[model samples]
Target chain A: MELFLLSNGKLSGEAELLGYAKRQLLAMIERRNITSAVFVPYAMIRGDYDQRAGELSQTLGIKVTSIHHAESPAEAIAQAECILVSGGNTWMLNQMLHENGLIVPIQRAVREREVPYVGWSAGCNVATPSIRTTNDMPVRNSVVLPALGLFPVQINPHYIDAHISGHMGETRDERLAEFCAVNPSESVVALREGSLLHVCGNDLRYFSAREQGFKVFRHGAETREYQDTSALRSLVPFTCH
Target chain B: MELFLLSNGKLSGEAELLGYAKRQLLAMIERRNITSAVFVPYAMIRGDYDQRAGELSQTLGIKVTSIHHAESPAEAIAQAECILVSGGNTWMLNQMLHENGLIVPIQRAVREREVPYVGWSAGCNVATPSIRTTNDMPVRNSVVLPALGLFPVQINPHYIDAHISGHMGETRDERLAEFCAVNPSESVVALREGSLLHVCGNDLRYFSAREQGFKVFRHGAETREYQDTSALRSLVPFTCH
Candidate 1:
């Protein structure tokens, strides 16, 4: 399986979507000779789906077609050479994936056919076991269904340590700690902005555009930061490269 | 029904829990002649429940007993003079409320017997029609059940407009706007820290210990700030005082 789970779609000053990982994306595209991809934009509420697809197409040099345009979304996923998931609202994205019955098809495409899956933010969230570690609000009244689970461990995208002054709410760290406390046996990989986790076959790699390290959170243990994927081997099957 | 839906329990540099609303709470207790109250501490994941109850007792000059110590939680709610909810994790608190069968009993006590209901943070989120506007992460695997719905409209506690530098995640305004986009017919009252909404029978009042205004968010409408409860009357059946 090949996957590119990005922390977010854009950085602070970059105008192009996914511009921070352009070289890596171009390398994968060239190696696979991929030309077209199916885009999942269900996480978006106020944003235009096709406009985002166009931006992604321009970013990765591929023909990105939003699944909403297809009469059969599952079929679109089944026949696509690549899968692209955008970031917006995790709850809505997960709900739409379940509502449109595209979860299994995407899973089969990524796992069995070795289709390349690229996702950022909320897209990165659904790649995990569940949407339990998301930072978005639960806007919909629908039931919380399990996610695609393409990746084995829970991940928190857009992770940060800063807090707005005088904002008396749970910080990102506090929320992740609460998640760890509730699920003591589980671990959460917190990916800061401009960072990503890439997996190819049995090899796993970590990258950060800002040269920052990722943190691992667990219950009854100190949250430690690492510059590489050495700590993730025990949680996932991929060998650190 | 008598209700005190607080934005948070404590403020910056304040050591006493619920100290911001001490005067109003004392007045309510004196008017109702309340001596003891039942505390719901399910929202607390790492904090000590008994210690929090003790602090609340000291703040209000009334006995605060945690409902977890009761032999029957529903029975305790039925016999209690008042209900106090703490601030912590909303998902766990709502799930525990459903699991312990306290939803209907608390509803009946508040609606029928007019039990004074006091809740802060997560407690305030559950008082609305749903927990969709809450700012906490959904860390549990339980189904999304309807909240207590003590308040007719949704209330977002710990609401802020500031953003941390370099964080790419959605801001509080954007998240609430997304909620409005999804639920067009509903409105969310964004309460800042050290603020609260008090309801007594047919009268409704808004108070911010820091003298701040609250904002109302709706789909395709300007999010306007109000220093009084005049704008909330159309959404709920209460006279602004």
Candidate 2:
């Protein structure tokens, strides 16, 4: 299985989508000799689906087609060479994935067919066991918590430590801590903006465009940041490469 | 129905819980001649329920007992004088309400029996028709979207326009706008910190201790801030007092 679970789609100053992971994405494309990709834009509630597909095509130099254009979304996933998921609303994305019966096909494509899966933000969220660790609001009335378990552990995308001045709501750290408290046995890998986790077969890698480390959150334990994938070995079968 | 849907329980630098709405709360207590409140602390994931109840007892000069100690949660709600909900995780709070069979009981208490309902943060989120507009993370496996419909329209508590300098995630406005886009017929009332919506019988009032106005978000319409409840008459059957 190959997955590029990015923390976010774009940085503040960068204009191109997924520009931070351009080097890794280019290497993956060349290694697999990929030319076309299937784009999943269900997470985008207010954006143009085909326009985003066009952006991804220009950024990655691939033939990108939105899955919505296909008559059957599941069939599109079944024959997909590469799967690209965009970031927007996690609830809507997961709901549409289930509603269109594309969950199992995407899971099989990534795990069995070794299809490269690239996702950022909400896309990164669905790669985990569940969407319980997502930062997006539950906008849809029909709530679906289960997601594509491409990655074994729960992940929190777009993780940040800074708080808006005088905002009385729970901070990101506090929200993650609450998740840890409720699910004591489970762990959440918080990926800050510009960071990502790359898993290929038995090898796992971690990268950050801003030279920042990722934090691991667990119940009854101190949340500590690490610069490598040493702490993730216990959660998944992948070894640091 | 008599309700106090508060944006938050406490403000920064304020030592007392629900201190920002003390004046209105006291008036409600006097109007109803209420002496005790049934505290629902299910939203509090880490804090001590009894300690919070004790703080409310001191702050309101009324006996505040956590419903966790009751033999039957539904029975406790049926016999309660006032229902007080704390600020915490909305997903867990709504789930617990459904699990303990308190949804209908609380609804009957607030609607039929005219029990004074006071909720802040997660509590306020659950007062709406659904918890879709909440600003908290969904940290539970079983996702429950239905909430106590004391308030007809959806509300976003702890709403803020300011953003952390470099966070790439959607802002509060964007998230609410996405909600409006998905639910075009519905509107979201964005309540800032230290703000609240009070409904007494057939009269509706809006208050913000910080003197800030609340914003109304709807699809294909301008998101505007309002200092009064004149704009909400169309959404609910209440007249501005």
Best by DockQ: 2
DockQ of 1: 0.85
Worst 10 residues of 1 chain B by lDDT: B137-146
Chain B superposition TM-score per model: 0.99, 0.99
lDDT of 1 by residue, B65-127 (tens): 999999999999999999999999999999999999999999999999999999999999989
Error of 2 at A186 (Å): 0.4
Off by more than 4 A, model 2: none
Query: Candidate 1: which stretches are off by over 4 Å?
Result: none
Per-model root-mean-square deviation over C-alphas: 0.7, 0.9
Positional deviation of residue B42's Cα in model 1 after best superposition, in angstroms: 0.2
lDDT (Cα, tens digit) per residue for candidate 2, span A1-241: 9999999999999999999999999999999999999999999999999999999999999999999999988999999999999999999999999999988999999989999999999999999999999999888989788999999899999999998778889999999999999999999999999999999888999999999999999999999999999988788888975
Q: Give the Å error, residue B151, model 2.
A: 0.9
Error of 1 at B184 (Å): 0.5
For each candidate in the order shown, give its overall lDDT on alpha carbons.
Answer: 0.94, 0.94
